[model samples]
Target chain A: MPHREKTRILLVDDVPENLLALEALIRRDDVVVHKAASGDAALELLLAHDFALAILDVQMPGMDGFELAEFMRGTEKTKHIPIVFVTAGGRELNYAFKGYESGAVDFLHKPLDAHTVKSKVNVFVDLYRQSKVLKHQLETLERNRQEQEALLQELTETQEELRKAITIRDEFMSIASHELKTPLTSLKLQIQLRQRYLKKGDASAFTIDKIAKMVESDDRQIQRLIRLIDDMLDISRIRSGRLTVHPATFDLSELVHDVVDRFSEQLAAAGCTVTLTVPGPVVGYWDHFRVEQVVINLLTNAMRYGAGKPVTIVLEAGDGRARLSVRDEGIGIAEEHQARIFQQFERVVSASQIGGLGLGLYIVDQIVRAHGGSIRVESALGKGSTFIVELPVEGNRASDAS
Target chain B: MQANTLLIVEDDPDIRACLEEIMVSEGFEVLTAAHGREALQALQSAQTLPALILLDLTMPVMDGPQFLAELASGRWPEAWQRIPVLVLTAISEPFLAGGVAEVVRKPVDIGVLIDAVARHLPVSLS
Candidate 1:
């Protein structure tokens, strides 16, 4: 799968005949020979290609072997190329020392020995190939290390997220059990009281009235249990990504009014007064049923948190967008808790104080976003909160309506 | 008459009413409060201290723990201190550390609740 390139050797001499002789002597199956007639020509070849070894003639017309070697040593590109100097001059110690000082690996005497030159060239070529392999392996190792570190970081984050999810789930289960038991206890007591009255044969008007009241109380508790179960099912649907929205053209103001009217009894019980401010009909293509759910959730939240306070709902449509705001004058959310309130199983108030699965706002957020809208809150401690939802009028209508 | 009095402290109106009716039919005088704070207020204004208190653990404004703490803090009248508390809760473990006569878990059997109340009530009152 991986292609291996041939090792290259450069032969440099001013004389063409000497270049041919050197090239012929060093040419092999694994190596490619490049012949350059002068130092300038050799430098040109070196710049264009990578060579395992360079054989240079000490005596040249210009830019001789020592000068070329010194120049190559100064340049980063050619500095590591092993140089072997070949000269027809005397076997003098000073010439050899000068060759070594100029970055030559070996110096050969005149009238060249073919066997010795080949062996020396082979040694330098082998060293160059080994170093290249080592460098490649080092690069591979570094890359593997970096990838491993990234995977480890991802694993750690995923583990932390999983831990938090488990804790929330445990807390939710505990709260759910408690919530279920409270109404169940009341329901059982109501039934037992009715049975006791019936066994006593007490058919008086007073007994009848008390029984009627207990029956009504039982109905309320049963409704609460049903709502809790419904909320749990909604959470499952949301988690499975199966929540569907069926949209149609409708007046947003009318829908808001209708939802508010449905909560009139609860609002009165909480001592909360709601004021609706809608100047005109604001039409939108959205899921009417889902939108009703959102309004109901917001209103219920307002009544629960804004007990004995005034709540206001304002609807305005302009510039291809519809905006609805629900403002409550009650105990407000803290700045840090505003964002967390929209997450599943998260509540700003303690579970003991408030009774719910804490899935209302999360389901509301999901439905609003599915309609190509955004929801946000503005609140301060003890000042109250306003939940604003803005939906696009035209865009995402087709998909939503479908 | 004072010794037969019993107090029911619970937030749920339906449950509180049901308990009160049950206790009244059992020949005991029942006083009710919506929460711990209300219970304390009722105790402060009572002409005769209740012989026993049926306390629910979780409630808004103030809970069972707060009520027990206030009762033991030596601020209430001496007669209120001797009244035994019967804890009613849905939690697995008892939330109260001390000053509780019994722990009754919900959804509690009416028979068991009534029996516990009778056992904890002062013999003079019963």
Candidate 2:
């Protein structure tokens, strides 16, 4: 409630002298008095102000004290105001009963007792002030309850997110253990076999061709271990927001060509070939090393799952963006698995068959995003997949926006 | 004398190669398959039943458990089911498979693996 300096009371009487006398008795610096000669005029005042009390004269020319009190009772805004009826009649006339019937809190005789009137008005004013203070306190409590409810809802959502993160962490640990153990097993067995030959004094096991093959096998396993460890490091860097993109101007076509040229030996080993469809020099400003990493990841995936089929690389640039896509016609991913492939440790095929850490596409996605670029896949089961990436031509725009 | 033959079923090419090399050096004729479906095909077409089998649990197109279930479904001769299978795996869970004689965790000790294979063989390799 707004702070009010004075309490207001209505005084309605036919004679101006009677109203003035009553007002003088109850009026104080903290009290405001409104006087009216008729019931209609008093009602007008009643509708305009919130009064603490209303004292009505019984013998008015129109609308007597009892009738005015009934009117105030019927009105929603004025209904709660305490009514006091002042009449010149004696106790035998029973005006007090009628005044009480019309909802008057008290009755006053025309030979008004000044102390009683002043004291009654003061009591009503104090009651109104106390009720207003109580209402203010109730509003404060309701607002605090609502605020607490909102905070509890936020906490529940955060807890659910934390639970999901922990599950992912646990799953990643298991997969990592399994993948790392595979190469270690191969290495251990190879070395044990060589050591046995050495113990048996078998010079035949160290023949030029046999030693070359052993070195090759060891190198392959070591490379596989190195690749898995690098992927794990990349994931940690991405999660920690430390995957920085240092942008520089370069031709995307040349980069694709270079990546393809480098992957030629791997492609042939997998019995796969590449088809490049670069119209011209599609140039852009992007992180050179990171973009090369993206290319290598995608191309490696293409060859790995391409089922010895031809892989296609396409590049185009226009309207401040460069688009690169790699398409393979091998065993494709199902629609449901396509979206999840870019997430951490997600693979469409079994780990036993493919022999991967399942972080290739995820790392590729993070690298692309760090360069203010986006990656998406269009694939269906057994029809093959096309991975598309789009990057902004502007240099370091991702960092600039942040 | 029963022929000393071993069938190896696995998907990873490198691991498959290593297993083949180890078995061949041990004076055993080995038949290899990339997955369960291929292993089944090889078994159906073979002239003689292998004395023992080495199986990896996880694979594409078909898996070890699925293959074992098929082998026990009366699709092949009763002699085929008699061939003991040694399950070699990296998975850290207890697996259930029909006709699995023993389970060996990978990074397997060669002596332990050989002893297990010998115990399941109809006639031990010389």
Candidate 3:
């Protein structure tokens, strides 16, 4: 997939003249050549750099060609490189004996044959090229293995983070439950104590007022805590695929009316009005309870953003899909947040003034999908936003491919 | 220093405040803290060391396991070691109190909390 490292060929000869002569013999691209003038120099070169082969001179001062060849063969690093000797006017048996004993692959005579050197060197070069390819392949595999290990490590880290998140969630649940219990206990106690005190003429005006305030405060706290716990449990059930749906055919218009009736107080508190317009009857199959949950979540969202503006719920039917649209006039969804609003655990950025866990739209999306339906949101930053949920009439029987 | 007082260690305010009210109305001197670190600190400096510690499983700084780890090695101040810690938590894993002395579940009745404290040692109401 990428480029390769160059090949290095080292030539060793005692005489400078022979070294120069040998260097000119072979010229090829993608090959690097190094020459050494003596056995010691050749050994130094071998230590400094890796070579494919050492071309040695048979005649030398301190280290004989045969001795150098033996040294190259003995040492661990230099042993693998092939050795070829250059000699002149020697007996055939002596030459053959020296070559084989000293570990020379072959000997070339001093009246240096250029073609012969080129041909033999080519053979070693080809061998060098093949080994390089194998080595490169090994390196590539190693790199890929390292990358895979890093990815696995990252995945493990993510899993650990998720585990911590779940633990925090569980801890929050326990604390929330305990908190709810305390207030409920206080409320019951206050109510009982005040009723007894009144019945027994033991209730002073001060005592009665105190107990009343206590009951009111504790009741509010209990309600808030209960709602939080319910939301948490709902998300947990939805995520684990444990939430069940009770499907039935119902008039979509009636369901919307009930949802509106339930949310009347919330709408008033939020200073928002609601309006609904629908056809006489749009028949739809859905889990009524879950559909109500979805409707409430959408209404809450509308109330939050629509703030005093009328949230309109319009139901229409066409192409075997029943469409439900909720329009809000408050600060509409920004383009960036619109994309992510349907993602689990995503909250609107910088909207902390409104308290939410960012799971409402996500839950809505899931409910819509389970009914073999789709939802689309259209919004601009400053203008009002519209969310349309379209459901198939026969959601339960729809084929997966469709 | 009184020998009988109930200790409660929890990071959450509502949980701590609720438990404090429960214990105080039950006529026991109650001590409270937000986490294991502060609990240990309070334990070390208290004019009256508590007879029992109601420990939470998780907290802000050091958690239940870390506290137990520290306590098991006996690295805590000597006075702190002798306190019988009742590991009050929502987690049912009583084994989380491996090195600690006792265990109790949260959202338990105030009467149950009092009995748990009374069973270990007499608590000071004075």
Highest DockQ: which candidate?
1
In candidate 2, which residue pairs get closer than 3 Å at backbone N, Cα or C atoms, i.e. clash? none
Query: In candidate 2, how many Å is residue A371 off?
Result: 2.5
Candidate 1 regions exceeding 4 Å error are A1-3, A36-47, A59-64, A70-75, A87-104, A204-208, A248-262, A276-288, A315-323, A390-396, A400-402, B4-7, B47-50, B63-83, B93-101, B122-126
Name model 3 segments beyond 4 Å from true: A1-106, A110-230, A349-352, A400-402, B1-126
Top candidate when judged by lDDT against the true structure: 1
What overall lDDT, based on C-alpha atoms, would model 2 receive against the true structure? 0.83
Pick out the ten consecutive residues of candidate 1 chain A with the lowest summed lDDT. A93-102
Task: Report the C-alpha lDDT of model 3 over B12-49, residue by residue, as the tens digit.
Answer: 45456667766765566888876677787878778888
- Segments of candidate 2 deviating more than 4 angstroms: A1-23, A28-111, A207-210, A247-258, A261-273, A279-285, A303-309, A317-321, A330-340, A345-358, A392-402, B64-83, B94-100, B119-126
Candidates by TM-score, descending order: 1, 2, 3
lDDT of 2 by residue, A1-402 (tens): 434645788999999999888888887887789999999999999999988888888789879887898888889999888887787898664454443554437777768888888888888878777776777788889899999999999999999999988987876776777778777778877887788788889898899999887777777778778878988998889889888888888898899999898667668767688889998987788899889889989998998788569998888887888899999998999998888999887888876566577899999999888777899999999899999999888856757777
Q: What overall lDDT goes with each candidate model?
A: 0.85, 0.83, 0.72
Better of 1 and 2 by lDDT: 1
* Interface RMSD of the candidates, in order: 1.4, 2.4, 8.9
**How do the residues A259-326 of candidate 1 rate in per-residue lDDT, one tens digit apiece?**
88866765776678999999789888888878888898888889877877999999999988899999
Q: What share of the true interface contacts does candidate 2 keep?
A: 0.42
